[model samples]
Target: MQFHIPAGVGEGMQLTVSGKGNTLGRHGGINCDLLVVIQEEKHPELERDGNDPIYNLNISIPDAILSNTTEIPTAEGRAKIK
Candidate 1:
């Protein structure tokens, strides 16, 4: 089955659908709104700080002391940083 997610959807954002929950009492007179919770899993290569993502890089002592250009992985793609 296909699902439709809106273009403006982002992390911590919530969408509510009316009258999707169970009814109260046997007669089903009152309907309750469904409480949907949205959760995003943690990324293996990055950590989140507010809305930004942080990447940690480990370099050797020689590389740290010397000037070098290294390739690092990011959410977008591989990036080269000096």
Candidate 2:
């Protein structure tokens, strides 16, 4: 089933949806609550520190010599970092 998730939600968080689980015993009986466990997908260039995401960028020697803005990946998309 599909559900809405808000921003800044961390891993291992639990959410409960009422009346969305299997029936208690028989048909038309009381329904159980569904538990949703949040799991985070691994990011190739990022690491997790609690709720914060850390990205370590390595630049080439030539590019380091000449200062320029570089595009990096973010949760909202790509961002430029100087």
Candidate 3:
């Protein structure tokens, strides 16, 4: 089965689907609701803060001294920060 995760869902959040879990009996007993816990996969370039993705910009000493735009990885794509 497939389920969609809504936008801005945070880590450790729980979602329930009605009557999707184990059933009580064979004779028309009610099925338990399915509970899903949300877990965010670690991204190499980003960390999560609440539902927002954060990227710490770290520039080399030469780049910082030269005042050049440094390209860094962001959640959406590569970004340049001076």
> Which one is best on TM-score?
2
TM-score of 2: 0.73
Once fitted onto the true fold, the runs of candidate 3 whose alpha carbons sit more than 4 angstroms away are 59-70, 76-82
TM-score of 1: 0.51
Task: Write the number of the candidate with greater lDDT, choosing between 1 and 3.
Answer: 3
lDDT of each: 0.72, 0.84, 0.84
- Summarize candidate 1's per-residue lDDT along 2-78 as a digit string, tens digits: 23456535567776656677887898678777655567776778877776778879888888888688998787778
**Regions of candidate 1 where Cα sits further than 4 Å from its true position:** 1-12, 16-37
TM-score (all chains, Cα) for each model = 0.51, 0.73, 0.67
Order by lDDT, highest first: 2, 3, 1
- Which order, best to worst by TM-score? 2, 3, 1
Count backbone clashes in candidate 2.
Answer: 0
What would the per-residue lDDT of candidate 3 be over residues 1-82, giving only the tens digit for each residue? 8877799887789999888999989998999999999887789878888767787776789988999987878777888778
Candidate 2: residue 48 Cα off by (Å): 1.7
- Model 3: worst 10 consecutive residues (lDDT sum): 50-59
RMSD score of candidate 3 (Å): 3.0
Predict model 3's lDDT versus the native: 0.84
Error of 1 at 58 (Å): 1.5
Q: Model 3 residue 63 lDDT?
A: 81
